[model samples]
Target: MAEQGPHFLMVGGVPRDWRDKRTVAEAVFNDPLPFLDVESAHTHEVLSSAMAAELVDLGEGIIDVASVRGRNRLLTRAIAGAHYSGVIEI
Candidate 1:
């Protein structure tokens, strides 16, 4: 038998109003351990332990990409643009 993997329930929403230009998305997993697994270092940015803790305290890991700084900000902007353009849903 093949090994089974954790399952994730992903939900995403965009506000009816575009004033804030923000999207809310969540990934709920059956197992918490798999949530921290990164398939590739080049494709993923590892958050510091402190940062992860902070996110857990603040909105349960949901981030306001507009308020993010540095390289992540750029990545978020691209994703947001793609979402708005209908290239991607979430």
Candidate 2:
């Protein structure tokens, strides 16, 4: 037998705009917390991977962003630089 599809599809990380507008990276690293409510909710009300990573302080390993759009190199670099981890796509 042979595989029909990719066992693992690799992608980049979260976009700069998406993270800047949605996640609490700025607040966590800089700035002050005024409202303390920085969660970004889509139509389905689901937390983004970037937010989740920030919350948990993602250090390393591949980040699965299959549901997100506009993934690119800059996003990956930003996340990796922030966490100082080797973040890749899975």
Candidate 3:
């Protein structure tokens, strides 16, 4: 499916001005974050797959945007980018 509605990028848990999804995806793809163990790989696989498919779920309560930190924030942004691209539904 293709994106719907006006384009906007999710910033700080809120939608902002439109930016190409590809650009956002690239930034997220190369983002560096400290990992301790399995968590890092798991996170990479999940977010990478989402980026590849441009499909993700921004389910309620999954992220506390105001307090999210580290890799969590990057993951959130990835999903948000998908949403903005209309590749993923909210």
Per-model tally of clashing residue pairs = 0, 0, 0
Which residue ranges in model 3 land beyond 4 Å of their true spot?
1-71
Q: Please write out the lDDT profile of model 3 over residues 1-90, one tens digit for every residue.
A: 557556544456443332344344443547553332323445444445545533233333333333135455555666555545665432
Point out where model 2 deviates above 4 Å.
1-64, 67-71, 85-90
- Per-residue lDDT tens digits for candidate 2, residues 6-67, read 44433564457755787655434475323212222331122335445553443423334432
- Ranked by TM-score from best down, the candidates are 3, 1, 2
Collision pairs in model 2: none
Model 3 pairs in collision = none
Q: Give candidate 1's TM-score.
A: 0.22
The 10 consecutive residues of candidate 1 with the worst lDDT sum are 34-43
> In lDDT terms, which candidate is top?
3
In the order shown, the candidates' Cα RMSDs to the true structure are 19.6, 20.5, 18.1
Q: What's model 2's overall lDDT?
A: 0.39
What are the lDDT figures for the candidates, one per model? Answer: 0.40, 0.39, 0.44
Point out the higher-scoring one by TM-score: 1 or 3.
Answer: 3
Better of 2 and 3 by TM-score: 3
Ten-residue stretch with the least lDDT total in model 3: 58-67
TM-score of candidate 2 relative to the true fold: 0.20
Where model 1 places Cα greater than 4 Å from the true spot, the runs are: 1-71
TM-score of each: 0.22, 0.20, 0.24
